[model samples]
Target: ILLPLIFLEKHLKVEVESKSETKGNRNTSFGVKEGHYLVGNQGIYKVCKFLGEGSFGKVAKCTKLGSPGFCAIKIMKSDRAGLREMETMKRIKHLDPDKNHLVKMYECFSFQNMTCIVYEILEESLYNFFQKYEHHIHLCHIRVMAQQLLTALEAINSMGLIHCDIKMDNIMFIRQNCINVKLIDFGLALETKELTTVSRVQVTPFRAPEVILGLYPLDKSVDMWALGVVLASSYFGKYPFSYHTEYDTIRAMVQIFGVPEPEVLEKAEHTRGFFVLDYEDDDLCWRLQTPEEHEQITFSLTFSSGCWRSILKEELHQVKPSCDPREKPAPQENLEKTEAPHTDSDQAKMPIGVKKRKKVFSVKKDILLIGNLGNYKVSDVLGEGSFGKVFKCHKEETEDIYAIKILKYVSDAKKEVEVMELIRDLDPDKNNLIKFYEYFTHRNVNCVVYEMLHQRLYDYMHKPTHLCNIRSVAEQMFQALSALKSIGVVHGDIKLDNILFADKNSLRMKLIDFGLARKAKELVKGTKIQVTPFRAPEVILGLPLDESIDMWALGMVLACLAMVQIFGLPEEDLLTAGEFAGNFFTSDDGGNDPVFLDLLKRMLEVNPQKRIPPSQALAHDFITMRHLSGESAAEYFATAKTIMGSPSSSSSSNSSRTTNGNPQTPESKKLILWR
Candidate 1:
């Protein structure tokens, strides 16, 4: 009995043999059946078993007659298609001989009137490898796979070819560990310079937005987009725009990436058919129209002036939680919930004009401006995650450096933008808030153009843990939260990381990451969005919250300063500080700064009733001892209105409409803080 070769032929460059390795007559059973023999250009291959089926054909395992090895043979339905893939393989193989991540095509031949494309036997497709593991490949390993996939794509690109259909299924693993994979199944591959034979290419979920939008003159960039989606899916354990249906893919795209540019919408062939202009906030959120609404929006039809506004208002009112009618519920219904993301199907009942955001995405790269609405050039990557990446960008014509965070989920970015607006209204001066110059949806990313400041307190902490002006820093935070309380804002996640230095000297700092902040009254009972270590006792104990939690986190921030002073690191941290709450910051122990300790005691109180609210903290001795910032909400508003001019003022005034349609703005926020 011939033991099937442990290895497979590496290349299609094979030599015909004079003698057959198999003893006598080669077993002739059937197509793709084990022990069946098939003749190729080089030798007779004994069929081992079936591998998998693809768009163009079925793949099966086979052993070469003269060679001591096994190989994969894809039997195509038609010779024309099979040879096309074979030619593509040959081009790719010739393009890069030194190294190729693509699966090697050993040989191709006809048997029983069917065309078969042969390849080295691969263990499994990347999709199957990941699915069997419950989509839990560590990013470290996936990174290696990504490098290999990119190399393969570059090889294909060098040959001026596009792997039109790039997905986990088309990427196969060479070995069981799955670190090294190969690009397989070029059945739908097309040369970049070839004439277009199809209107669109790529699988539904993995398809690029440009392809879906009909952004023509497609190039190898389309393949790059597919690679991004493929890598993102592996990293995130789901598609950046997790659409289960082809019809919903557009909606998913819009949701993941904010609405495309107006020009993109106007130029896109399918826009009219798929999306409708939602004018809820005087901004157009392109929501996929329902069957009836599709035709109306798809075709050029003059809309009744206020037809959308009324439908939008009705939809908004219906979605508003009825349990608490007065207080606007935090839009965090999707946040941290043990459920799937709200899908388009679930929102089908809502009016087309309803501003239900589509969950979709944009991968990195491309020289386009971020959020076509804003004029900025993205340059470098600052940070990255499954949801998004922070890019170093600057105003196109100016040196105004800014960090542009491109989020995968439009919901996350939209939520953050809402909180920023909420905070801005509350603290118009932005004295204690990250100064948001503008935010717009650019290239499907929630492009937030903020005043790029120095490193965060977390980064500064490394330089000198022994905070010199810890009280002064604490004073600014107290004021920020105090300003927030006056307007009913709660900074949900306050940590050293969220507290950033606003100036070069690290003298002034502001709070950021407002995406999680909720209204004090609207915060769901037991809702906890704070990082674990910074979580207040009330939040951890499942109690109701108020603006006091921010103060609690500030207390932890102060304690962290003290811990850093004493141990260079927070040993047990604030969570355990409650056990010795009374003497936690005592003079007898250190007396480092009695004023700071006094404030920490009240701020760290376990009882929400006992915790020092921002209002009283401003009047505390620790704050009055220092100089006030002198930037009152009134003065700041006056100066801001002056700088913004008439147009800005009008926009601000118009934007004052509340969630409940109230046109009245909140009273001027008056707060004092240490400079």
Candidate 2:
């Protein structure tokens, strides 16, 4: 058998040969000969060969009667192309392919009994590439790919849609001068705009445990979980959960990552018994059982290196009964005796238990105190706002200065002991936002720890004397926005107040005060408009604010930063003493800053329909100056390049072992890592 070469001839003349190496352990069939089939009655096209098949239909490399280059035609049954699926595909097609990582659909054709969609031909499937370069997949590579996928899903989700099927196979790679990947196959995509009351149906393998265990009408977060699995698989060179057959895969998902049983619920107060546990809350039950009973259960699940092992430790705790007298006895071993399980060299033994143990997350009760929450060691209070209080504090360890924001009664502080708990849980790229170190509350005082900053954009702007350069400030704000954009998050409040500078040169800034901050998926819950003066028109008009909102605020901040740079101070007409000033901090100079005026006009367009998105904002003549100067954003934010979109769920990837060396017992490993 002739093995297929990596490089193929441009002309589709000779018969293609199958490569001997099976990429990604995928099922391969190579006997079909190259031929042409009538797609519809419109025209005849030559079919070089079959590419692959999905639930949608067959995909093949075909050339039109008059066209020269090959195109990928995805043919589906015309009958299935209904209002729902077509609408999803249409939106996916219109998305900015250059900015969004979703596949670019050139066109869709429909005739009599067939529906065909054409796309730019990708050289190989992501799975194929993974198979080709399995060993070379690094955590950094996973971060880049995962970030791109997150951005794509963020766009889909922002539009209130969900991609039901996301996996290695559906991801395609565009390899040339740059590595651009596109998410393909939206046959299972569903519109979730009005799905609050409806149920969400999805595919397996890529499905989250919540979906598999009958969780309904899943949100865009389901895609987040799937992306997590894809990223984990790419890094570890295997799936987190895999089986011989689809049935086994489903069964394993339930048995291993499944929800807890009711009878096993003694002392499990903080977690919901019927739902899967989230690691973010520290209080959520990670393990279900006690130590002694953890040694008996024999079933084991496969473990790929880099897979979250801590969640497994929690699952073991749930299944094993604690030897502690207060806990119930371990569940009967009869069930395990009948089940066959997959095993690996590192697989832990399943714990046997009837009692559920309380899951612990990172947030705790005691608060750690830094300097005075209201007073800064170095400088007086620079600014205070509804979200938190900013004090210019000097670090005892680094001696490097930072402006620390002390927030009491954080938006959800009643339920969340610490604000950083949520931020840390999200695992965001910390560079864009001020880094929070610890949190402690003392007698009506809640202090959030952060790196100190030299001054705030607010202080720098209103100063009578010009200290640092303004263009440098714009560069910092843009860098922060770029970082936030990449993380699938929106900095709802991106004004002078929130932007804090680390040093007196005042060129670099970090976003602070996240009281009103939320994940990108949470659009409808909070107040639609944040800081109405500088708010985007869409937000002001009560339209759902996405990244465009950030861009809008970014535009205004850039303008203000520019004025501070050029005029040596903020225009008096724009500066206000109180926090309740109008949304747009404009000056009587009538938008006099020429460079900023042009930039802000585009960002503050009355219609979100017309407002510039982040990708476009980065391309704007004003902000692109840095890129034009041939500098990557990574130069400023050292960690920007390593940010993964988010963790799959609250579950930690690493699993801990028990005294008996059993992998499944709850009493074994301490589940320290969450998010």
lDDT of each: 0.54, 0.47
Write candidate 1's Cα lDDT for 380-487 as tens digits. 776554446677776776657787767656787887788777766655344577877677875555776666766666654332222324545655666677677677
Residue 649 in model 2: lDDT? 17
Give the top-scoring candidate (TM-score).
1
**Taking the candidates one at a time, how many backbone clashes does each contain?**
12, 46
Tell me each candidate's TM-score: 0.43, 0.37
Looking at model 1, which ten-residue stretch has the lowest summed lDDT? 339-348
Model 1 TM: 0.43
TM-score of 2: 0.37
- Name the lDDT of candidate 2: 0.47
Q: How well does candidate 1 match the true structure, expressed as C-alpha RMSD?
A: 29.2
